[model samples]
Target: MRRFILIFLIVILCTFPAFAQENYCKDKEPWKEWDKLVQKYPHNMDIQMLHAVRIGFCKKIEDSTITFEVASDAFNHLHETVYKKDMAVKVREVLDEARDSV
Candidate 1:
């Protein structure tokens, strides 16, 4: 039983990214950009697609010009096959709404 539990934990830990628990761009300001996008767009589908990979966007939040470019790279890395689209969409929506208040 102990061996089985150890194996299960090892598998689980290896499957999940070490930084998965934290925001993608911990140093960058996720809320700052999230607010701008939400207030101007307000649930726009195009923005939905944009937000689906927000971690990439978050990375460039420090600079306005780099946001889109870095976000593009982030999208490619997302590898939807590994990360579910619905989860990304939901994460984006929640973050956007949470930051919209600003």
Candidate 2:
């Protein structure tokens, strides 16, 4: 009986991380779609802005410790182009919000 209980406890502990990750992914599902859109329209400022906002929203919803690494990459891409100054500013604002949330 003691061995059975120990095995059951070990199994439950091992499954906990998977269960938590599943819930995290469910909460982050919308962000995943936004990421896909960003990939599809790599140069579209509007889509990038949407993606940044979604990242911020996901950060808020998940109360995650994660930072806006992907958003930072997009911001860097936009920053490289002189023509996208205004759009870069907008994306930067959203990324800042996401960073602050973390």
Candidate 3:
């Protein structure tokens, strides 16, 4: 009975991190839209950085508000620059609305 309880507790502890991470990017309204943008523009560095910021999952240096490291070499080769420019403008507007809604 004691061994059964110990195994059950260990299994529960192991699954906790998976449950916690499953919702890592669903906290804000902008994040929901941003996830779609990530799929649409999979190679845009700016959009990727915004996603990282929303998830709190990027490396940063001191005294820097606009500089950080993304965890991919693909960020170096950017695509959809002109198209994502329009999407970015709309995202900013929606972000402001989300902020006000909260």
Candidate 4:
């Protein structure tokens, strides 16, 4: 009976969404992927800009589309959070200027 209960709890936890709004950037791959995209086209500000926009887009939307914010806070640079491994979505207002330099 104990074993059955443990299994049931595990299954229930698994059913929940892996990515939650508060901590979506648990995986840094998305931000890393964006960086790689920037490296590919050094002069292509357009593509880089798009990538930044995507990060910010992921943050603004409340729906469970993308997990994480671009997090540009001093404590959390680029896609990092101040005290956590998670990344924050990029804020859209300065996306263009930031990407232009990245």
Tens digit of per-residue lDDT, candidate 1, span 8-68: 3344335435435454465355456545665666655444454555644654664665654
True-structure lDDT of candidate 4:
0.43
Off by over 4 Å in 4: 1-26, 62-102
What TM-score quantifies how close candidate 3 is to the native fold?
0.29
Candidate 3 lDDT over 1-102, as tens digits, reads 323333433453345345343433334654565577678667766556655644443233233432333322122222233235545666888899999999
lDDT agreement with native, every candidate: 0.50, 0.50, 0.46, 0.43
- Candidate 1 Cα deviation (angstroms), residue 52: 3.0
Question: lDDT per residue, candidate 2, 19-95, as tens digits?
Answer: 44433335465456556656766886645764565456446546755434543344335433423454466588889
Model 1 lDDT on a 0 to 1 scale: 0.50
Residue 38 deviation, candidate 1, in Å? 1.7
- Give candidate 2 regions above 4 Å deviation: 1-29, 64-102
Q: What's the residue-level lDDT of 39 in candidate 1?
A: 67
**1 against 4, candidate with superior lDDT:** 1
Error of 4 at 75 (Å): 28
Instruction: Summing lDDT over every window of 10 consecutive residues in candidate 2, give the lowest-scoring window.
Output: 1-10
RMSD of 2: 20.2
Off-target runs (Cα >4 Å) in candidate 3 are 1-28, 57-102
Rate residue 60 of model 1 by lDDT: 60
